[model samples]
Target: MATKSLKAKGNELAESNKQLDILNGGIFAEGELPFFKDKINEIGHFPLRPKKLEILQINVGYMCNQVCEHCHVDAGPDRKEIMTRETMAQCIEIIRNTGAHTLDLTGGAPEMNPDFRWFVEEAAKAGIKDFIVRSNLTIIRANKKYYDLPDFFKKHNVHVISSMPHYTRGKTDKQRGDGVFDKSIKALQELNARGYGMPDSSLRLDLVYNPSGAYLPGDQMALEADFKKALKEDFDIQFHNLFAITNLPIARFLDYLIASENYEDYMYSLVEAYNPAAVENVMCTNTISISWDGWIYDCDFNQMLDLKVASKVKHIKDYNEDLLNDRNIIISQHCYGCTAGAGSSCQGTVA
Candidate 1:
C-alpha cells in the first residue's frame, strides 16, 4: 500500500488526456473535472503501474442478451463483435507462455461468443488454475443452447461471477431490465441445483452487486449478508459470495450520471473515499485485460475507455511478457473508481 508522491509530470498527463474525454462520452474534458487528479495529488501517486501479472482477463465479445442501463460495455443483442477462434488461440498461447494462473473471460455475455466453450476448453487444458466467467445470468436462461452452461461451468470448475444488482426485483430490474430479476433468480436456482454455491461443492457461484445508481458500493460482507438473507428468505436462492463493485464513470453509466446531474457528485464521492491501501491490489497490477479484437489494456474499465496498455506489447498477438511487465499502466480520472473506498475490481473490494 506504499506510494510515492504524485509527481507533477504524472498528474499533467493523467488529467490532460484528450482521448479520455472522448472515451468518457464527452461529458467533461480531462483536467476540466477537478476531482480525481486533485485527490490523487493529496494522496500521492497519480498514475499507477503494473506489478507481476498473474491474471489474464479477456473480453471475448460485445454481444449481450440484455442492454442494461448501467452496462459499461454497452453490450446488446444486436452487437456483432465477437472473438474468433484465431484470436482465442493467440490468447491461449499468451496465457500458457505468461504463466498466468487465472484466465478471466467476460463479454456482452461471454457465452454468447461462438468460441467461448472452445476457449475455455483450451485454457483448461493449458493448466489454468482458475477460470473466472463473468456472466449476465439471463443469458444462461435465454436459450436452450445456453441452458447447459451451469453444468458446463461445473465440469471445467470455472468460478461463476454474475451481475445481480440487487436481491429485490424492483431494484434489480430497474438497473438491468424488466423481467431480468426473475430470469436471474431462475438461473441462480439452476446453478444451485447443480452444486454451485453449495457448501460442500467445489463449484463456486459468486454474485456481483453493482451500485444501482451513481454511487459507491457498500461493505462487501454486509451486502453479501443482505443479498443472501433476502434471496434465501424470499426465493430460497443461495450463493457462495458477493462482490460489491463500484460503477466506474464510463459508457452508459457515465451518460446516466450526466443526464441525472449526479456526475460531479459521484466523482467527488470516489475521490473523497480514496483508499491508498487498495492501490497495491488494484486488479490491473496483477491482471492484463484483452479486448475482443486482441488489444491489451490495464483493466476492463480501461479497455472500455480504449486506454490501451502503455506497453509495446499492446496486443495478444504480440504477447511480450517483459515489456508488459516493465511498462507503466495508462491512468486517467476514471481510475478513481478502482481506488475509491474499499476499492472496486473484478473481484470486489481490494482493501
Candidate 2:
C-alpha cells in the first residue's frame, strides 16, 4: 500500500474546522500530547486518504440492550437514534452498487433494529463477499424473538463477529453487565451447535476481545490462543479467531477515563505506543462508516465525533464511491487510538 506523500501545508488535514475543534479541545490541546497528524507526518503520511474502499460499516442504530462502559457510541436502551426503513432503503441501494466487498452491520445490537431481518434478507441477495453482523452475543438471549438469530445469521451466510470482553465471567460481566457472561456463553454455544465455528466450516464465528479497563490490548495471536483454550476447556466452546481491539478514548470511554483520572495517562500510552507502519493499513484508508441516519464518515470513531466525510459525498443517499475515495481521510488526536502498538481496527490489529 504505497502512499503519495502529502505536501506539508496548513490546509493539509488538521485544518478542517470541526477536526480542529475536536483535536484542539480535550487533553490533546490542554496537555502536551503529540498530535496524531504530526506523528503520521513524521512518516510523510499527512492528509490521509482512502484506498480501495473494501468495507462499508453501517451503524444500524444505537439501541443496545447492554450499555458497555467503554462503548464509544454511548449506545444503550434509552437512545433513540434508530434507523428508519427509509434510510435503510437508501443503504440498500448503496449495498447493491458498492465496490466494497464487505458489508458490515453494527449497532447497540443490530438485531434490535425492527427491520433487521428484512435488511439482512435483502442484503444477502447482493452476494457480498463478506457480510458481517457485530452482535453483542447476549442479544441472542435478550428475548425470545432474538432466539433464532444464530439460525437467521446462518441462513444469510452472515459472518458472526460477537463481542466477548474476556473468557472469564468476572471480567466480561464487569465491562458489560451482570449475567452477560452466562448469556454470551450460551449464545456462543448455540452458534457452535450450528457449526458456525467448526474447523473448516464456511460458517465463521469470531469473538472480539476488548480490554475491560483503561488499557491497550496485548498481542492478537496470544489473546486468540488464550481465549480459544479457555472457552474450549471451560464450556467446550469453539471459535475461529479472536480480535483484540484497543479501547479508544471517546464517548462513554472518555467519560470513564475522566471519571477514573486516567485520561492523561491513557493518552500518553497511546502516543508512546504509536506505530507509523500501522498507518499504512489503518481501517480508515479502506473503509467508509455510515451512521444510523445516513451520514458518512472516515470511520466509526469519526462518525461518533460527528466528523462527516471531508468530501462532496457525505451521505449514503448521495454516495459516490469515486468522489468519496478522492477525499482526504479525516484525522485528529483520537486517531492515535487506531495507530497505537499493533494498531487497532474493527478487524483487530493491522500491523
Candidate 3:
C-alpha cells in the first residue's frame, strides 16, 4: 500500500510537470515573481567583495535552444540580446590588463555568436591560463556550422563544461526538450572521441547537473557517480568530473514555485538547511560575473536578477579591483540555495 501511494504521488508530480511544460511552452520555462524574496529578506542587503578577480566570466548572448524550467538567465530561442563585437573588444582589453587566469564564456549558446570563435582565439592569444566555455550541447548539433566546435575547442585547449540534467533520456528530454537528449549524447560522444574526459586527456570536459524541481540538489559526489555510471553504461558516454549545482530561486523557477504553491515550502527548506560555513566558499567571493552589456555582479545568479556589484565600478571599463575586493558580498534569500546541504555554485558544492 505504501509503495502504491508513493507511485501515485510520483505519477501526479509527473502529470503536473507535463501541464507546466504546456503552459510555459518549454522545459526550463520562465516563472513569475522572484524566488529568493524571503531569503533576501532574512539575509538583508550586502555588497559584493571581490577576492582578486581570478576569473572573468562574460555573457556573450542571451539566446538559447532550450529553456529549462529552472533557468535563471531566462535565455531562450526568441531572445534577441547578443553581445556586440565592440563589447568583446572592451572585454579583451580588460583581459590584457587584469591578467585574470580564466576567461569563462557563456551565453544562450556561446557558439551561436558570430564572433565566438574569434573571441576564443583572441583570449587564447592573450595567454590566459584557462579558457572555459559553458555550452548547452544541443547547440553544437543544431547546425552544421557549429559541428566543428569540439575540434576548435580541442585545438585551443578550451575547457568545456556543459549542462546535462540527467543521464536518462526521459528526464533529460523532460527538462530540456524532446530530441535534446539524443543530440546532447551525440555531442558528448564527439567530445569524448576527441580525447575529452578520457583517462589522461588534457582537453577537459565536465558536465553540470541541477535538480528538476523546487527542492535543493542531493549530494554532489553521489549524484556525479550515478551520472557517470548511467551514462557510461547506457550510452558508452564518458566525461570528467560532474558539477552538481543547486537551482537558484529566481526567474522561471520562482514563477514555478508560486504557480505550484511550493514557494513558501521551498524557501523554508533552504533556510532550515543554511550552513554558515557555506558562505565562506560562495562562488561570488572568488569569481566575478560580467554581463553582456559590461555590468559586473558578484556572481552569475546576481547578474540574472540585475543585482550589480555594490561598488562604484559596475562596468568593465571602470572596473576597480581594490574597491570590489573590499566590498561585502551581496546577500539575499536566494543565497540559501548556495549554502544548503554541501552548498552549490557554478563549480558545484561550496563545502
Report the number of clashing residue pairs per model: 1, 0, 12
- The TM-score of candidate 3 is 0.86
Q: Count residue pairs with overlapping backbones in model 3.
A: 12
Q: If the candidates were sorted by their lDDT against the true structure, best first, what order would they fall in?
A: 2, 1, 3
In order of appearance, the predictions have TM-scores of 0.90, 0.93, 0.86
Model 2, residue pairs in steric clash: none
C-alpha lDDT of residue 277 in model 2: 90
Top of the candidates by TM-score: 2
Alpha carbon deviation, residue 239, candidate 1 (Å): 1.0
Per-residue alpha-carbon lDDT of candidate 1 for residues 219-244, written as tens digits (9 for 90 to 100): 99999999999999998888999999
| lDDT for position 80 in model 3 | 65
List lDDT for all candidates, in order: 0.81, 0.86, 0.77
lDDT of 1: 0.81
The lDDT, on a scale of 0 to 1, for candidate 2 is 0.86
Q: Compared with the true structure, what per-residue lDDT tens digits does model 2 show for residues 1-351?
A: 001111121223213344346456776676677678778888989989788989999999988888787887767776678888989888999999999999999987889999899899998997689999999999999999999999999999999999998999999888898899999999999999999998999999998999988899999999999998999999999999899999987766766677689977988898999998999999999999999999999999888777898999988878889999999988878888899999999999999
> Tell me, what's the RMSD of every candidate?
7.4, 7.6, 8.5
Which regions of candidate 2 deviate over 4 angstroms? Answer: 1-23
Candidate 1, residue 52: CA error in Å?
1.6
